[model samples]
Target: MRYHINFGQNSSSFKLAVIRALTGILLMTALASCASQGAQEAELAAQEAARVAIEQEAASLAQEQERLRAAEISRQQQEQAAEQARLQAQRDRQAAEIQARADAERRQQEELQRQVRAREAAIAAVEAERQQKLDRITALEQQITSISASVGDSENNTEFLQQAISVAEELLDVLASEQEKYEDTDSQGNTLRPLAKDLIAELEARKDELIRRAGTQ
Candidate 1:
């Protein structure tokens, strides 16, 4: 009975050792599984953050390109407006120059017309004056011829002869005055002074003959 009791106690101690070894192995396996799961979750979070950063960078680049395009369009519009203004100013200057030339030509034409009218009026005035002088000369010649005819028909009458001498003297004085008006020649190129001198000589001789005849009667 003492040997059997010692064998039973030794069997109980071996079973307890086997149970402790199994518990230690199970704890180690659970710790290794939890660590692997944590590492996988961290890798996934890092990938998500990289994708968000790339999207934001692309958006900023697109905005910069749009701003540059708007600035180019504004610059082109300003250049076009300036060019149109320059062309308009040039056309206005040309129009003004053309109007000035036209005005100058019109003034010149008006002045020329005025000068022509004045010249025509002056020529008409000269012609009228010449006609008046010629009519006066013809009337004087007719009066002298009528007086000479009456004197020839009344030669024996002493009163008529004396009157004829006085009349003839008055006509000679008038003819001398008329001759003084022509220095060189008349308008028709006639020697009016020489003809008037000859008429005065003939009238003077006739007046002397009438004076003698009056004394005899």
Candidate 2:
């Protein structure tokens, strides 16, 4: 009976040791599964952070390119405006030069017309003066012829003879005065001075003859 009881106690102790070993193995497997899951989550977080950084860098580069394009457009607009202003100034100067030339030509034409009119007026005046001088000379010659005829008809009457001598003396004085006025030669290289001198001498001789005839009558 003592040997059978000792074998029963040894069987119970061996069962307890088997239960302890199984519990320890289960705890180790749970710890290893948790470690592997944590490593996978960390790798996924690192990939997400890299993608966000790349997107932000690309957006910044696009903004820089837009700014450069705006500045170039503004510079081109300023250059076009300057070139238009320069062309406008050149056109204004050319217009002013054309107007000045036209004005000078108009003034020159007016001056030439005035000179032509003045020359025509001067020629007409000279012709009128020459006609008046010719008329006066013709009248003087007719008066001298009439005086000589009257003197020959009245020689026998003493009172008429004396009057004829007085008239002839007045005529001789007029002819001498006319001769003095013709000091310069005419355009034809002749003068009325010699004819006036002959008339004066003839009248003086006739006046002397009339005085002697009147004293005898």
Best lDDT among the predictions, by candidate number: 1
Among these predictions, the greatest TM-score belongs to 1
lDDT of 2 at 187: 41
For model 2, how does the per-residue alpha-carbon lDDT over 1-217 read when each residue is reduced to its tens digit? 3554676788888777777777777777777777777777777777778778888888888888788888888888888898888898889888889988888888888877776666555545544444443454454345446545555675565464646546564754555455454554444333434445466556657765665666566
Kindly provide the TM-score of model 1 when superposed on the true structure, using C-alpha atoms.
Answer: 0.44
Q: Worst lDDT window (10 residues) for model 2?
A: 185-194
RMSD of 1: 11.6
Q: Give the residue spans of candidate 2 off by over 4 A.
A: 1-57, 123-217
Overall local distance difference test of candidate 2:
0.63
The total of clashing pairs for model 1 equals 0
Model 1 misplaced stretches (Cα beyond 4 Å): 1-50, 126-217
lDDT of each: 0.65, 0.63
**Candidate 1 lDDT, 1-217, residue by residue in tens:** 3554676788788777777777777777777777777777777777778778888878887888888888889889988999888899889989989999999999989988876776666556544544554564465456456655655675576465656547665655656465455445444444444545466556657665665666566
TM-score for each model? 0.44, 0.41
